[model samples]
Target: MTKLRQFSRNLAKNGLLFNLFILSNLILSGCTSSTQPTYPKESIDQAIQDICKKEYKTDVKVKLVGSTLWIYLPIPEGIVEKSNKPEKFIERFVIEQNNNELKDEIVSVNYLIKPVPEQEKLQDMKYSKAAFDRINNVWKVLRRVIFSMEHPEQNSPKFFVTVTADTKNGFLIKEIFYYPDFKKVSYELMSWGEYQHRAIQETEVSPKIIGDTQGLNLKYSDISFEDFILQQIQHRIRLKFQKPEAEKNADIDKEILKIIRYTLKAYGFKDFSTLELNNLATVRKITLNQTAVFSGSGD
Candidate 1:
């Protein structure tokens, strides 16, 4: 019995010593690991780069486009021609920096439309002209409505101007982001005929009609050019990322455009014109001039 006890005591002592040794080893390793410090900006850029490298396609290229760092995932060259009509198209992802700080991220995407392209000569002139006129008419009406919303004092008609656009028609719009300087950063969509604009005042929701309101009638100067750019980019991203199920049921493209107009209340852009181009040939040069109403109510 004495011998048995001595053996058990020896085992216990050895086990305790082993545990202590392990604990000391762990502490020393942790101290050694703490020697290196992490870099903030390098860490951020590396994380982003790693993520893009793993996930996006091979054709998707990343580059610093101007002040913005862009991940350009261009549509395939073959896909550009009208043969296989893809439902949705992935364009590119953009990251903007402000004062060397991450400003915003934008993903530009497009919807797939029908109407196959013919390699042969152009279609009948009369048919083409009529189609062009129809599209132009819708574009003109939209511009007028947006203009009216930006300028509330511009003769409020008996009825609110009906906001309309070609729902079935495929169009593109661009959104940009910048921070800090108002003059430096401006978000504008490049797509012609597709735009969002809202009335300066909520004519539908008047103060007298809804009596629950206190006297906090703060009017903001219409959307700034900087804010305008962000909203446009947001609109495009939502459409691209929207769930497949939801996109099928909803006019996601149109919904996204409307969201931009309503979200920022960009009731300032008025009287804009753009050149119409043939889809077959690439457009070399295009310029657009838009007049937007300026206000300092918010300031």
Candidate 2:
């Protein structure tokens, strides 16, 4: 039998408030990638470095370790701010429903609302000009480089996008994401709201030399790809409760169930017997078995 879904309970404090956060994950897939690209892995760094320096006038550090591509960019100073980010566009809701015991209960749900660029304030956008440009540059450079290789994968299955936010304090903003998720929105394979829901971020205060060659001062965290995905889902959920927007009047239960359903199905994770969700605010806990989670599977 494979490993089971494990749970570790802890209380998180935010200013004057402390909410019990439930953080647990079940990874059903293998830790390693099934297929590594055919590209010459050694030349990857050189190609990215040359492109960054010559084309963007910015020196970038890139490494393709296993299936994940790690890129660090020292974008223009204001790309990342030194303050807390606004958590808008994520809606939460609750509704009444009856369970199998013939009793009425409340179900909670949260959704990542779509961004209306026209009506959205500058603060609402995910990236500042410099941040967006630098990330786009990385994507562009990778595509150019991969085009020269035989049978390019066209995208990185997993990637780490790290940017230097504050030089004085050595603040770094790191986001781990699945590259093709952007395409999913375009292809209508997933909703724009679903795409926006991704969240595996590390706004670390790691001290490091600024403008140094290849981010030599930065250290690579030895984290597994599956762990990253779990963290992504956990953080995304945490944000919904942390800094929420207007509460929508929908079935929060179904909303959350849909989120979990999409994520689990996408990754082929089905080994878990039960999923646990706890609310420290109310001292309430709900455990849903695999049958309830994937309710349609029996049919």
Candidate 3:
């Protein structure tokens, strides 16, 4: 009887252990669902929209082009930005402005660069507090959707651009955010505040065509971040000194150095070894070494 009773107890213990093992396996499988289909098999854009609609109670337009993902956010209320520094045109006078006797032509130039934020602190009273949250939330959704994909599309986007459109006013703002830097933010290697700051700087509060020129393609491909930055430097120079009547074109050259140094210093980008600034209109170029930029001397 004692032996039979001991056998029954052992059996019960073994059964309990087996049941626990099965339960754990089920739990483990449930956790592995992160690799599972996060969205429908139909399309990624649909998945993003559905998830955003469910999560934020909002609507967003998403388009995935070759190697790029574009998200357009609609704002019924127009974006109101603070005033920018007035452009100072060079005062030049020529009897025959179109004469071939001129050494350099003071033609208008268009830049192929997207604008970035000057500095967060400098942007006091610049943008709405809600704008930051709106931008960051959409970005977080994009990150989550991309990372959760077990198998991405063949084009698998490497670049992410978000555009905010004021539906009422028909004004649009485009921003390109670097994915590697965003991954750093996700991994906690970088702070969220810093990440958001970079994102803010990556957009334009007021974007006008090259020297406000017409017939220029406003939508441009920024091949790299450095290309974007260099274009920004060129654009700032062009906008600040748009005047054909400058006392000296050399002042534009000097302003180029000042703007480059100032803008680069403010943005905190230190990777490049050299930069060649080109005046697309004039075909003139200014080349600077890395040392020349961070040498701690006045521009």
Best TM-score among the predictions, by candidate number:
2
**Candidate 1 lDDT, 95-153, residue by residue in tens:** 12111111223212233322222222211111123323332332232222322232223
- Write model 2 residue lDDT over 1-299, tens digit each, in one string: 00000000011001101100100010111122224344565577677788878998767877776666677776535344322564223223221221121112212222333222222211221334565566656655655464444444543435545444444435555656565653343234665445445535545554464444456776666445455555655555444433342244433344445556666666665655666543433444566767776664411
Give the runs in model 3 whose Cα sits over 4 Å from its true position: 1-42, 79-133, 151-156, 191-275, 278-299
Cα-based lDDT for every prediction: 0.25, 0.46, 0.45
- How far is 93's C-alpha from truth in model 3 (Å)? 25
Residue 55 of candidate 1: its Cα lDDT? 41
The TM-score-based order of candidates, best leading, equals: 2, 3, 1
lDDT of model 2, residue 243: 32
Model 2 scores worst on lDDT over the 10 consecutive residues at 1-10
Candidate 3 per-residue C-alpha lDDT over 1-299 given as tens digits, one digit per residue, 9 for 90 to 100: 23223322222111222212322333334433244355432376677777767987656777666555667666554433432642222223211111111112221223222222222112211233444445555655665676666454433365667775545433445655556555555555655434432432222323332122121324534345554445455434433433221233344445556666765675676666665554444556665666786673434
Report the Cα RMSD per candidate: 30.9, 13.1, 22.6
